[model samples]
Target: MRTPAAALTGVVALAFADASIVALALPAIYGRFDTTIVGVSWVLTGYAVAVAVAAVTLIAVRRWLPTGPLTMGGLALFAAGSTWCGVAGSLGGLLAGRVVQGIGAAALLSGALELLSAHVGRERGRRLWSGAATAGLAVGPALGGALTEAFDWRVIFIAQVPVALLALVVLALSRAPALEPESGEPTTNPLWATAGYVSLFAGLVGALFLGVLLLVEIWRFSPLAAACVMMALPAGTIAAGRLTATAAPAVRVVGGTLALCAGLVGLALLPSASLAWAAAALFLCGAGSGVVARVLSPAAVPTSAPLVRSGGAVVAAKHAGLVLGLVVIAPLLAGSLTSGAEQAVVTGTGVLLDARMPVQEKLSLALSVRDTFAEAPRGAVPDLAAAVDTTNRSEATTAVVKEVDHRLSAVLTRAFRPAFLAAAALALLTVLAAFAVRKTPIGYPRWRAAPTAILAVLVLAGPALVAAEVAGGALDHGRYQETDPCAAPADPYPGDGVDALVQRVAYGALHGAACELGLSRERFLLALAGQPGFAGVEWDPSTVERTVRAAADRALDDVQQRGDLPGWTITLVRAAVRSMPLEELLRVVGLR
Candidate 1:
C-alpha cells in the first residue's frame, strides 16, 4: 500500500526547497525586472507576506475543504504563479506571481506539516521533518545556484509543476485517514494572531536586512564571501534545533529569543570587529529564531477540528518574519543613511549625505575636505597642501588636510554609530518578540513546525542577508584585478604558466594595484575568485594576466559608463592602469 506518511515528508521538503530556490535566482530576477534595490526585494517580500498570511488563515480555509481538493487547489495556484513568474514581462507582474506562489507555498507547507503531525507521533515527526527541512534548506541554495547557472531562471518554477503534480498523484493514490477538525474559536484570533506574527516577522527580517547591509555596504564584503559568512545563520539554527529537546522548553524559547536580539545588537554594533565574531552573533540570532519558530508551532495548532488552521498559523508566522526581514529592514538601513544626513541637517542644513564621500568626512567640512584630498592626488602634492587651497585657509594645505581628515573621520564615525545602535535596538526588540513564542507542553508531541520553522529561519535568512548586501552594493558587483609584475612594462605582457610565476606576475600585479589604490588586493581577489564562475579556477600566469587586464579594462569602462568608480574599487583601477595607462584607464573605466 502506498503510504501517506512519506508523501507528507516529501511535500514539506519541497516547500522548504522552494523557499530557498529564489535566493540564487535573485541576480537573474533583477536583470529581468530592473527594479530598484528596495523594490526588487518585494519579489521575496511579496512571497513571504502571502505565505505568512496563508499559514495563519489556512486553518479556517481548510475547515470545510477536504485534503485532496485543498492540495490540488494549492498546487494549481502554485502552478499558475509559477507560470506567471516564468513569463512575467515586468517587475509588477513578477511580484504578483511571487505572491501567488507564496500563497500556494504556504498552503502546501502548512497542510503537509499538519498532516504529518497528525499521522506520526509528534516527537518522531518533529525529528523527521526537522531533519528533512534542514536538509532541504541546506540544499536549496546549491540547487538554485546550479539551476541558475545551467538554465534560464524561469525553468526553476516550470520545473516545479511536475513535482506538484506528482505530489497530487500521491495524495490521490493514498488512503490517509482524515483527522477530525478542532471546533471552537482559537486562543489567538486569526486576524490579530496573523498581525502579531507579521509584526514579529517584520522585526526579525528588518534586523537581518540591516545587519547584512551594514556588514557589506558600509563595511564592504564580496557577495560570495558574504554568502559564506551568512551561512552562520543556518549553522546556528541547526545547533539550536539540536539543543531544543535537551533544554527546558520555556528556557529554550526564551533564551533563543534573547539570543536572537543579541545577534541583531552584535550585527549592528560589531561591524568593525573580526568577521568571526560577527558571524558568531548571526549564528546565535538564527538559533534564537529557530527556537522561536519551534515554540510557536504548538500554539498555532489545536488537537481538534480545523487542525490545518493552527498549522497554517505557524507557517504564516514563520514566513511573515521573512517578509519583514527583507522589505522592512532594507528600507530601514537605507533610511539610516538618511538618519546620518538628518543628524548633519540638524547640525546644519549645509551638510550633505553623500554616499560617494570618502571614508573621511566631518559633518561640517566633509565635501571640501574630500575634494581637497582627491585634488591632492591629481596635483602630485600632499593632500594637506591641497586642503589649504580648497579651504582657502592661511595654514598650509597639509596642516588643514590633517585637521579636516581627522574631523571628517570623527563626524562620519558619529553619524554612522547612531544608525548601528538603532539597528541593534530593533534586534533586541525582535529577541523580546521571540520570547513571546510560548513553550510547548512537557512531552508534547514534537511539532513538525519547530524544525521546519527553524530551518526556514536559518537557511532563508542566510540568502536574504547576503542579497540585502548585494542589492545595496556593499559587495562590488563581482569585480577584481591584479598588479603589474614587470618593471613598468609599456605593454601588458604575457607570463609563463608556473604557479609561482603566475603569483609573481599576476598576483603581484593585484597586490601592487591594491597598494597603490589603498585597497586590500588579497581580500578583493579572494572575494572575486569566490564567485561561481571563478571559484577554483586557479591562479595561473595566463589566466591571471588575461583576467587582470580584463578586470582593469572592465574597471575603467565601468567608471566611464557609470560616471563613477565601481564600488570605489581601486585595485581594478590600478590593474587597468598597469595594463594600459591613464588614457586607457579612463577609456576602460569609462566604457559605456
Candidate 2:
C-alpha cells in the first residue's frame, strides 16, 4: 500500500517536472530543427500555454471528476502524450503532443490533490503537493540535461511513457479516496494573488530558461556541464526550503523575489565564463524561487473553495506567468543573438588580425574564420578550433591557436549580455508584483526563515558587487577591448607535457626570430596583424606583402650576421611569408 501510494506521488511530481524539463533540450531541438531561438521557444511556450488553459478549464469541471478514475485517466493521457511527443517528426507535431501533455498534467494535479488529502490530512496533502511541484521544477533542467547528454532529446519524452504507465497501473489497483460534496462558492481566482503569480513565474524565466541558454549556447558548455553548473539553482532553492520555513509569508515572497533579481542581474553582468562564477549567481536564483513558491502555492488555495478548482487557479496563474515570460523573452533573445553574431565576427576578425603570427598566416586565418562563421548555424558557438586546426601545425602556430580560441570565447560572452539583462529586468518586476499579496494565509505552515534569511540576502548581494562592471559594458558598444598582446612578456617554460614542450621550443625560436627582425618579440609578432591589408584599415595588399618580404629579407640577413640562429627556423618563417598561394610553402611549416 505504501509503495502504491509512493508511486502515485512520484507520478504527481513527474507531471510537474515536465513543465520545464525541456529547457536543457532546447539547444538540441533548435539545432535539430534548424529553427530560430524564437521558433524553438514555442516548444516551451506551447506547454505553458496549454497547461495554463487546462488548469483554468479543469476548474469548471472539478466537481464531477472522481479521484481514482481521474488519476488513472490522466496518467493514461499523459502516457499517450509522451508517446506522441517521442515519435514527433516535426516541430508542429511536437507542439501538438505538448498540448495533450499539458491537459493530462492538469488532470493529474487535481486528482492527486484530492487523493493525497484523503490519504493524509488536507494540510499535509497540500504541503506534499506543493513541495513535490517545486521539487520537480527545481530538478527538471538538470535531469533533462543529463538525459539529453546521455541520449537524444526525444528520449526525455519517450522515457515518461513507462513511468506514467506504471503509475497508472498502481493507481488502478489502489484504494480510492472518498469524494464528499462540498458546500462553497467556486472561488474566484484572487486578482492580486494571480497578479503576484504572474510576476513571480515571469521572473523565474530568467533563472530557468535564459540561464540554461546562456550556459549551453553562449558558453558553449555541453548540456551535461551546463546541467551540473545550474544545479546551484535547485540547490539554493532546496537549501532555502528549511532556511525560510518559519519566516513571515510576506518576507519570504518579497525577499525571495529580490534574491532572484540579484541573481539575474549577476547573470546579466557575469564576471567571467567560469562555471563556478555562473553557479554562484544561479544559487541565489534557486534559493529565492524555492522560498517564494512554497509560500505562494498553499496561500493561493482558499479553504472554503474546492481544493482541485482552487489548486487549478494556482497552476493557471503560475503557467500564465511562464507563458508571459516566454512571449517577451523569445523575441528579445532572438534579436540579441542575431546582433551578437555580427559582433562575434567583428571581434573574432580583430583578434586574428592582431595575432603574433606571420602576415600571410593572418590573411589565411581571416578567410578560415569567415568561412567557419558563415557555415555555422545561427545561435551556435562556431567551432573556432576548426578555423585554426593545430593537429600538424608548428608549435608557434599551436600556441596562437589556443590564444585565438580563448579570446573568442571571452568576446562571445559579451554577446549574451543584453539578453541576460532583459531577463533581469523581468525578474526585477517581481518585487512589485509580490507586494500584491497584501495578506498571506494566516497560520499556514512556514519554512522556518530563522537566521538563514539574513545570510541568504547577504549571499545574493555578494554577486551584485562582483558584477558591477556589467553596467559599464552595457553602456559601451559591443566592441571588446583587448590588452596589448605585446605588453606582457612570455611566461617561464610551461609544464613538462607534450604541448608544453612544443610551446617552449616554439617560444625559443620566436625569441630568436624577434631579435633577427631587429624588433622586440612582441613587436615582431604584432607586426603581421597590424598590416593595413589585414587590419580594419583600407586594404593595401601591395604594401603589406612588401612589408612581409622586407621582414623576411631582414630576418635572414640578421641570422647570417648573428651566425647563431637556427637555419630551419628561418626556413619556416620564409615559407610563411610567401604562403598565400605558393601552395607548396605549406610543407615547410607543416604540423608536427
Candidate 3:
C-alpha cells in the first residue's frame, strides 16, 4: 500500500510542479521566440486553461472511467506532450503542446487521489496527496532553474517524460480496491471555495510570476540565484503547515488571509533591491498560502461528492485562479513600465542638457544615450552609464551621467510598485472571502462580541485603505522635473543628397541588426568593436564614426542588391532615429 501510494503521490507532485516550473524561464523563452511578454504568458496560461477545462469535464464523467486505465493513459499523454514541447519550433507549437500536457495532468491528478482513497482510507489519502503537492511546489523553481541553466529551457519539459513513464509503470501493476460511491450532500460550499481559491492564488502572482521576472530582468540575478531566493516562499509554507496543523479551520483561514495581505503590502512598499526584505515578505506570503490551503483544499471538493469529482473541482479552481491573476496583473505591469520609461527619458534628457560640456560633445553623447534607450529590450532598464563614457572625463560629464543613472533606476523602481499594490488588492479580497467560512459560534457574553466585531472592522479597513491609495494614484509623483530637454538642437551636418542617404541607411541597418540580435544598438556596437582580434582597437569618437559609415555602406549594398527591405524594418528604423541627437548626423558624414 505504501509503495503504490508513494508512486501515485509522485505523480501528483510532478503535475503540480509543472504549473509553475516554467515561470523563471519566461524571459529566456521570450528571447528565444522573439515574442512579447503577454504572448509568452500563453505558455503558462494555455496549460492552466487546459487543466481547468479537463478537470471539470473529467469530474462530470468519472463514474464511467476505470481508475487504472485513466491514470496510465494520462501518463502516456503527458510523456508525448512533453516531447512535443521540447521539440516545438514556434511559440504557438509550444502552447499547443502545453495544452495537451495539461489535459494529461488533469486525469493523473484526479485519478491518483481516487486510487489512494480506494487502497487506504479517505483521510489518509487526502493527507498524502496534499503533502506531495506542496512539496512539488516547494522544489519546482530550483529544479526548473537547474535544468534550464544546465542545458536550456526546453530541457525542463523534456526531462519530465521519464519520470511520468516510471509513475505509469507502477500504476499499471499496482492493485487497489474499487472506489465506493460517496453518500449525502456536500457539507462545504463549492462556490465559496472557488472564490477563495481565485483570490488567494491571484494574490500569489506578484511573488511567483512577476517577482521572478523582476529578479532576472531588473535586479539582474542569474536564474540559479533567483531560484535560491525564491526558495524562501516554499520554506515558509512548510514551516507554517506544521505550526497550523492543530488550529481550527476558521482561525487558519482568517489568520492566513491577513498574513497574505500584510506580505503583499510590504512588497509594495519595498524601498530598493534588498534581498533580505524580499525574502522576509516572501516568507510571509508562503506561510499564509500554506495555512489557507489547509482550510480551502478540502472545502473545494466536499466529501459528499465522488472523490474524483471533488478532486477535479479543486484542481480546476486552483489553476483557474492562476489564470485570473495573470490576466489582471499583466496589463497593469505593462502600463506602469511604459509610464516609467517615458519618465526616465524626460529626466535623463534634463540631466544631459544641463551638463557643462561643449554643444558638439554633449550632442554626440546624447545621440548615443538615445539610441541605447530606443533599443533596450522590453522590461529591461537600460544602463545609461555604459552608453555614455563617464570615467576619465570632465567633472561635469561624470556628475551628469551619475545623476541620469540614478534617476533612471529610481523610475524603474517606482514602476513595479504598482504591480505589488495590485497584488495586495487581490490578497485583501481573499481576506474578505475568509468571512464566508462556516465557523461554530462561540457562546461568549455580549461584551466580548463588541471586541470581536471591532477587530473584524480593523481587518477590513486595511485593504480598503490600500485600494483607495491605488485608485487615487497617490504614489505617482516627484520623478519628473522637465518633460522635454532635446526638443530642438543645432544641426552639425545640415545638408542633403549622398550624406543624408548614407545617414538614413546607417540608422536603418543598425536598427534592423539590433532587432535580429536581440540587443540594444549600443550593446551591439560595443560587442562588434570588442571582438578578440580587435582587443587593442582604439574606440574614440572618430573610430566609432568610421565603423558606423562602414556598416552603413555594407547595409546599403545589401539593400540595393536585394531590391527592398521589409516594411516593418523601415518603420522601426524611422521610429528609432526620429529623436536622434544632432551629433549623430555629423558623425555619420565624418564632419566632426
Candidate 4:
C-alpha cells in the first residue's frame, strides 16, 4: 500500500515537472532547431495536445479496465515517448514524440490523482494533490533551466525515463484497493469538456504567446527583456491561484475564465505596442489561467470514487489547451503579419515608380528610395528589399523605413484585432464551461490555503518587481534602428570635387539645353560619369556612356585617396550605370 501510494505521488510530480521546466528552455530549443517564434512554440503545444487527448480518454475508459495495468501501460508509453524525443532527428519527430508523451502524461496524471482521491478521503485527496502539484510546478522552471544551462537540453527529457521506470516498479509490487467511481447524476462527457477547453484556450493563450514573440523578435528585444514584458502572465496566475482556492471552486473557475477573455480582447485592441499595455494583457490572461487551473483541478475530481477518470479529465483539459494554443493561434498571427508587410511594401514601391512623374520628382523619389535602405540596418534591408529594390542606396533607405513602418503597423492591427476578439469569445466560452462543473465540496483544510497563498504571492510578485526595476534601465531597442559599429559617415575627397564638377556639367547641360558640354579633365570627368542615364534617344550615346562611367570611376578613386572613402562609391556608380541604357545617358546629355 505504501509503495503504490509513494510511487503514484512521484509519478504525478514527474509528469507535471516537465510542464514548467520547459519554459526556460524555449530559447535553447529554438537555437538548435533554427526555429522562429511560431515554429518553436510547438515544443509546448505538442506535449499539451497529447496530454489533453489522453486525459479524457483514459478516464472514460478506466471503468472497463484494471487500474494497475493501465497505470503501468501509461508509464511505458511515456518512457517510449521520452526516448523518442531525446533521439529525434528532426523537429517534426520531436513534436510527435512530445504528443506521444502527452498521452502518457494524461494517463499518469489522472490515474495518480484518482488513486490518491480514492485511497484518501475526498477532502484529504484535494489537499494532498494540490499541495504536491503546486510544489512541483514551482520547482520545475528553475530546476529545468539550471540543468539545461549546466549540461544539455536533451538531458531534460532523458532524465525522466529512469524515474518513471522506478514508479512502474513500485506500482507493480503494491496491492491497492480499486478506486470507486462517483455515484450521482450522469457524468459529463470528458471529451466534450476537454474539446471546449482546448479550443477556447488555444484561441486565447496561444495568440498572446505568438503575438508577443513577434513583437520581441522583430522589434529587437533581448530574450530577458522580452520575457519581462511577458512576466505579467505568470504573476497573475500565481496571485489568483492563491486568492481563489478559498472561494467556491466554481466561482473561481467561471469568473477567472471570463477575466481571461476580457484580458485577451484588451490585448487585441491595444493601440500601441508599449510594454505596459502588453504586460497588462498578460497579467489579466495569466490571472485567468491561474484561477482556472486552481478551480478546474478540484472540480474535475470526484469526491466519491472513480478517481482515475476524474484526474485524467483534469490533466487532459490542461494539455489540450496547450496543443490547440500552439497549432491554431501561431499560424494565424504569423501569416497575417507576413502577408500584411508584403502587400504594403509592394503598393508603396509601385506608387513611387509611376512613369508620369516629372524628372525632378522621379529623381527625388529615387533619392528617397536609397534613404530608406540607409536608415534601416543591413539585417532588415533584405526583408524590406523583397518589397522594394534596395538597388538605389540614397533614396531606398528612407522609402524602406516608411514602407516597413506602415506595413508593421497595418499587420499588427490586422492580426491583433481578430486575435483579441477571439480571446474575448474564448473567455465567454470558459464562463460557459464553468456551468459544466458539478458542485463538489471545497476540499482543502484552512491551514493549507495560507501556505499556498504565501508561496503564490511570492511567485507572482518576484518577477513583476524585478521586471519593473530592469525595465527602468532598459533601452527601447525598437525596429529599423541602428546598432553598434555603424558605418562611418560618407567622406568625399578630391574625387568629391570631381563628382561635383560632373554634376555641374550634367545639370548645366540639362538646364541650358547645351549639347556636347566640355568635361573638366580631372574634376568633372572624375565625378559624374558612372551614374545611370535617363530614358530617350542619344547621338553617340555609347561613347558618352563609356566616358561618363570612366569619369565617375576616376572621381571615386580620387575621393578614396583624399577623404579615406572606400572605392565603394565608385562601385555603386558603376552598378547604377550598368542598369541604365546608353541611349538614356545621351538623352540626359542633350545629344539627340
Q: Write the per-residue lDDT of candidate 4 for residues 140-210, one digit (tens) a residue.
A: 55455566656777877888899898888877776666555455542433344444455445544543454
For residues 362-434, could you state the per-residue lDDT of candidate 3 as single tens digits?
7677777767766877556666777676665678776777677777776666677788878878866776556
The runs of at least 3 residues in candidate 3 whose Cα sits more than 4 Å from the true structure, single-residue gaps closed, are 179-187, 354-364, 374-379, 385-403, 432-436, 440-478, 483-592
Which run of 10 residues does model 1 get worst, by summed lDDT?
347-356
| TM-score head-to-head 2 vs 3, winner | 2
lDDT score, candidate 2: 0.70
| Count of clashes in candidate 3 | 0
Q: Which parts of model 1 are misplaced by more than 4 Å?
A: 1-4, 16-28, 55-57, 121-159, 178-200, 207-225, 272-278, 302-305, 337-592
Better of 2 and 4 by TM-score: 2
Candidate order (TM-score)? 2, 3, 4, 1
Q: lDDT per residue, candidate 2, 106-193, as tens digits?
A: 7887778778767765666777777787778778899999999999899999999999998888777778556554454322235565
Candidate 1, residue 577: how far the Cα is off, in Å: 40
Give the number of colliding residue pairs in candidate 4.
Answer: 37
RMSD of 4: 12.5
State TM-scores per candidate.
0.55, 0.76, 0.72, 0.59
Q: How would you order the candidates by lDDT, starting with the best?
A: 3, 2, 4, 1
| Candidate 1 structure lDDT | 0.52
**Clash count per candidate:** 40, 11, 0, 37
